[model samples]
Target: MTDQQSKLLKGKQILVTGGAGFIGSNLCEVLLNQHVKVVCLDNFSTGKRINIEPFLQNQNFKLVEGDIRHLEDCKKACLNIDYVLHEAALGSVPRSINDPITTNDVNVSGFLNMLVAARDAGVKRFVYAASSSTYGDHEALPKVEDTIGKPLSPYAITKYVNELYADIFHTTYNFDTIGLRYFNVFGKRQDPNGAYAAVIPKFVQQFIDHESPIINGDGSYSRDFTYIANVVQMNINALTTENKDALNTVYNVAYGDRTTLLELATLLKTYLSEFDASIKTIEIKHRENRVGDIPHSLASIEKAKRLLDYNPQYNISAGLKEAVVWYWEHLK
Candidate 1:
């Protein structure tokens, strides 16, 4: 992490697609802090204005109202950019199951457009948000790259396709790109009001509002819930590595630990109960496990450690504690 921080991106022209989304906004904030001139692009499909509102005053930051699905918009956003941190996409397994065409439009076609634009514009590197769900039905205790199972949902298929396309772009066009397969990432600025909001933010908001936090399938399923900071580190590291072997590769960005949903809810309840113990007694409801859901997922960070020098600072417990406080303070 320090390696990324030590090499400042001062005065570099950077374009962060999906810069208004949860992870995207966080990445933009970090890049701006490093004194980079940032161009942010988002169509607001799932991204929010509030995420980028604070940066409006920064002279070094620019926000473009554009969609990646539109090749012209991507072309315009990529002008004179040193790097592209592509984070825009239609996420959520349930949402993808409900409507796959839209997911394909945004996640697949949109990504292709960005690659072409970046390569054409001579961008230094392209880093994107991949998913742990790419492990799909592998049934492995700790998922490793290059051994993915068949993707079950449209969303997982989209992410897996992203890695494939990225490799093709590298060999075909010789453009530098990296894909970070993020585990469940939660942190500040994560929107909790959306229909497909992530687990941590959604539960935190519900508990704060004195509502019940629901668990699916008896809550035995687990994930390597990662924090936003670790992802930020990976993007920065990938962008700066100046190593040929690091380019055109994908790495799992996670804490390398696992926690079941039951454990997550209990932790949230316990933490929030500190302010008001009433939420602790709230019973959890178990619905039929959602379709396209995996039973368990943990990641092996050996590749990231070797290639990107990635070191995660926040484990799930420490991350959730900090994230819950942010949601309570920010969402309220």
Candidate 2:
């Protein structure tokens, strides 16, 4: 956090709706470090208790164990809150494919509940977790904010709906909001055990266990894999920026580069090999690409850079090195 950011966030009350999940917990940790009072609202469905365990002891942190699907819970969490970093949603495409109704309930309806709650409470700003998936089927490189294609899956639909609701909130209720369409984010404390675990952490844990990590396709598919710290920076900027032009819109929060699955698995193997040399011998397997997956995703972070002064510090290699080290120490 910059000196200005510290000063801006200091003593302010922020509510993180998914504060026990990977990205939300990271945001909570950063805000708490800046001496900001943080209220975390999560039902523990997809979020883990252990993720927010460290913050339980922090005087500046408070956990509100509640579901966002319920309007009452959203209202309760938003009480006296200055800003809302809404990260709660069912994230996986496969999970949504299996159960679109539940995904809609949480991602769409829950998101609307948060927006209404924030607007009613007169929260200063609402910064939310959008997805690069919203650029669905556009076949565009370096995705920009204005142009978006049809949603490819139920999960994508829910996320795009979030952006729609945010825009409506801004126009109809005069509520200020910013949506961050995050690329593939990874970092410390991210869960690697679940069935819907992210690629990097899952592969890292597999390598640590001397198991072959499976690539969904021939490994040519790529993503603008972003680091969590970059995302946190974007959220903080969105929350603290005084520029009126920066509000009531969305930004692609990314590291502005792409990496292939093969390259990513190779990088993980190389990094993890430092901790366990045997990991170098672990073969990477392959299968048909899953449904609702785009072939490639790269982000043009120029909008966030111009609007929010966003400058991501970690590229793929640097972030993978750091993530591998953490997984080695913890998951191993």
Candidate 3:
């Protein structure tokens, strides 16, 4: 953070809903490092307590055990909060296909609840966790903010609804907001055990165990595969930017590059081999493509660069090497 940006957020009270999740907890850590007061609200549904356990002892960090689906919980968390980094959402296409009702309830309805609460509480800025899935079926190489295709899954629908609600909130109530459509974010603390776990970490773990990690398709599908640090930087930029034009719009938050699944798997195997030579020999398996999945995803981060002065520091290889090291240390 620059001196000017640090001064902008020095002592401000910020609310991070879903602060116990992967991206949220990382945000909380950064804010606390800057001596900002952070209020974390989570129901421990998808969020793990261990994620935010270290922050429990910080004098400036407050944890509110609550759900965003409930209006009262949203309102309470917004009180005296200068900014809201809304990262709470039910993610994953397959999970949404299996149980879309709960996904809608938590993502769409819960997002509305957060917006209402933040607007009513007079929060300055409401920055949220949007998704690259919103660009579903667009068939575009690098996705721009304005152009989007039909949602491919319940999860995508909920995320698109979030963008709609945010725009409406800004137009109707004059609420200042920014939505970050994140690409395949991964890093330390990203859970690798679940059925819906992200590809990078899951593959890393499987390689460590010398197990064949199944590729959903023929491994040709690619992704932007953003790092958690890059994501955290974008959120901080959205929260602290003084540019008036930067508000009330969405931006694609990504590394501005793409990596194929086979390339990604090969990279993982190579990185993991430094720790365990056997991992390099582990065969990679393939299966039929899953439903609601797009063949490729890339993002144009120029809007963010021009508006928020965003500059991502880590690319795929640099970020993956670091993530692999973390998993080796902790999950080994």
**For model 3, the run of ten residues with the poorest summed lDDT:** 1-10
Best model number under lDDT: 3
TM per candidate comes to 0.97, 0.99, 0.99
Candidate 1 per-residue C-alpha lDDT over 235-316 given as tens digits, one digit per residue, 9 for 90 to 100: 8888888678888888999999999999999998898888777887888777778889999989999999998888888988
**Candidate 1 Cα misplacement greater than 4 A, ranges:** 1-8
**Predictions in order: lDDT:** 0.89, 0.93, 0.94
- For model 2, the superposed segments whose C-alpha errors exceed 4 Å read none
Give residue 244's error in model 2 in angstroms. Answer: 0.7
Q: Where does model 3 exceed 4 Å of error?
A: none
- Residue 298, model 1: Cα distance from true site in angstroms: 0.2
TM-score of 3: 0.99
For each candidate in turn, give its C-alpha RMSD to the true structure in angstroms.
1.3, 0.7, 0.7
lDDT: the better of candidates 2 and 3 = 3
Q: Which pairs clash inside model 2?
A: none
Is candidate 1 or 2 superior in TM-score?
2
Task: Return model 2's CA RMSD, one decimal.
Answer: 0.7
